[model samples]
Target chain A: MKPEAPMTAEQSLALITRMIDQAKGNVTRNAFYFLLWGWIVLIANLGMFVLIKLSYPYPFAIWLITIPAWAYTMYASFKRQKETSALTHLDSISGWLWITFGVCIITLIAFGYRINFQINPVILLFCSIPTFMSGVILRFTPLKFGGVMFWIFAIVSFIVGHEYQFLSGAAAIAFGYLVPGYLLKRKESQ
Target chain B: MFDELDPLLHSQLRLAVMSLLISAEAAEFTFLKEKTNATAGNLSVQLDKLQEAGYITVEKSFKGKKPLTTCRITTKGIQAFEKYVNTLKQYINK
Candidate 1:
């Protein structure tokens, strides 16, 4: 029979302490990302409601259905565990897709109708700034780098071309959120 | 000369959690619990220790009226992690 090695006091305490640190990190990151994404969804959806109301007749009825869609997406996102690596990326992408679609619809409606409201791409561009900063704060290179790309695209769209604004939003999804999120998920799996 | 890492931050389970969190923006209690395969009571206890050490901060709030607890690493914690890694590298290189 092999002799069991005695665990040192230093070893045990160090082990316990390390676990605690990690648990704390996990809790913090999840909460921040969830809130960040949730707010983005809410803002996008609310924008959608406003545009739909202004552009179409009988807006309240549409708002009712749109609210449910938003709720459903929220439920799905919250209920989802970090299961399959691919699923996690898919979920983020899909959520961003909803926000992108909502934003694009509103933009189209507002621009098409020539509503007096100036479509300030700058405001939308600035909104993404924090997300990019969050990526930097976390020190994840993929997210940080991708965030820069999103920021660049945002700036370009606002300064150069309003026609590509919606496309910029889609690009944000592909690079900033989805791709890096997927890569992280893959690293986790490995 | 690099000394050994403080034993307090060098345990396997703790190291695993920290490693995961180092890469994450934030993660949930459940997520950490599942990943580390630690019991709820054990994980909670460990988390409190880290919070007490000033290596992390804990936030207690309610989500939809359900009690929600979250954690985040502090600057102090990141520094300690880096130092610990450097300490370990000394042994490997030596």
Candidate 2:
């Protein structure tokens, strides 16, 4: 890469193409976030289902776990920001997109009581947007499949009864986030 | 009938640097060095040259206790790169 080397037009095109492909950036690190949220929500969904089946009074209280998960996500993001040496434009946009998704989820939670807490379907529907968008951004097919699964499961939750809605939500998170998350983790590791 | 290539982007290492910077929002000095496999001294010198031409902006700051240098391509750099590519395309297509 010496500056003095005379590069021909063809060589210049080759170099530009090689360098641009190399600059695709490390988007695979997103696997960790996907896996984290996937597991957390998966557990919460199944936990609510179990509590409901047991006739527990505070079945909905299971969602309080997201508070700690949110704190941990923020702390990890700050630490990650410190170590990142480059920022891709697509990555920046994806980060902002997820932030918007978080705002939407919060809005849903605040207004859930008005709809009699029929939040599972709406939450899964919101999840599909960022998941599908990230797949498009990263050119990862599994994530797109996961996004499709989320949509299907959202519909499933709408069709199911109260206690079974959590079960449908659990299946949604399993296929949507957990499955893609694991695949992404494996791909990144490779 | 062909436009001349921009001399600043006609060389090997500088062109590689611009290529990397053009695609990224920002890249660190170490990242460029690692990707280019260029010596630190040489990369630093070439970066200064691009900075002088106003083709890129270099920021020097501290990342914790260590110094960090980040580079980003400028609007002028994009234009120059584009012009150079168009010119090169003319040469090769001829």
Candidate 3:
């Protein structure tokens, strides 16, 4: 095939479309990180809810699981970066968006005591932005809907007491991360 | 009447390479070859031509035991590609 042949406008347009599709097709939708954080946050949220309902003295301590989760996520991200030979615009944008989300979460946790632990709703709200943006970038409707679900849960968490917020957070993680992550993994396999 | 398309971007292989690079921050030589289905020698020649025109920057390094070549489009390349597309549109519209 003469890939260097001169082209008319139609041929040029066709070639452009073909190349863009090829580049997009090469993208590996590895949802491992999403699944990892999904289960971790889901468990943490539900665990906290159960502890609080049981009248445990330090129910909030359950969130300490995030420390180990954060470490694992960093290690995984590094490995993924080393494995990747190309970085697409979507990948760069989504990576930075998640990094920004991570920084925001850390900041919120650092000041959680000052905020009287009324941080769940804000966290859910924050999560929606990156999730929605990621969905848009990847052109995945499930993830976009997942982001909307997070917004709805955030509103619910805001209206409920602190104890109920954990339950809402758990629901948010289930829909926002787990469901879409699974669907993405299935799509990649197919 | 249509403006002339940029010669550097008017060829099939070069245009294909530019299109791929346009959507990516950077791409490896193998990735470009795989996408374009171009032979390594031909791809190397076209890449060198694009580099000489200051349209792309190619970096060579060793990744573990293998040598890796990565290419990124320059600002000039992006502008030229955009102009080429616009000009192509004019030709198609006429």
DockQ of each: 0.11, 0.85, 0.75
lDDT of 1 by residue, A1-190 (tens): 0112333445544554565554334321332342344445434544445655477564324325446655665665566543321122223443464466557655654474475433435434544554455454444577666667667766766665443454555555456666666665565566
Structural similarity to truth (TM-score) of each candidate = 0.43, 0.95, 0.95
lDDT digits (tens) for residues B10-88 of candidate 2: 9889999999988889999998998889999999999999999999999999998999999999999999999888898
Evaluated against the true structure, the overall lDDT of model 2 is 0.90
Query: Per-residue CA lDDT of candidate 3, range B2-94, in tens?
Result: 688888888989999999999888999998988888899999999999999999999999888999999999999898889999999899888
Measured by DockQ, the strongest candidate is: 2
For candidate 1, what is the lDDT?
0.55
Tell me the deviation in Å of residue A143 in model 3.
0.8
Candidate 3 lDDT over residue span A1-190, tens digit each: 3755768899999999999887776655757877998999999999999998899999889889889989988898888876787788878888888999999999999999998878999999999999888888888998998899999999999999888899999999999999999999888788
Which ten-residue region of model 2 chain A has the weakest summed lDDT? Answer: A20-29
Candidate 2, which segments miss by more than 4 Å at Cα? none
Q: Residue pairs in steric clash, candidate 3?
A: none
Work out the iRMS of candidate 2.
0.9
lDDT, candidates in the order shown:
0.55, 0.90, 0.89
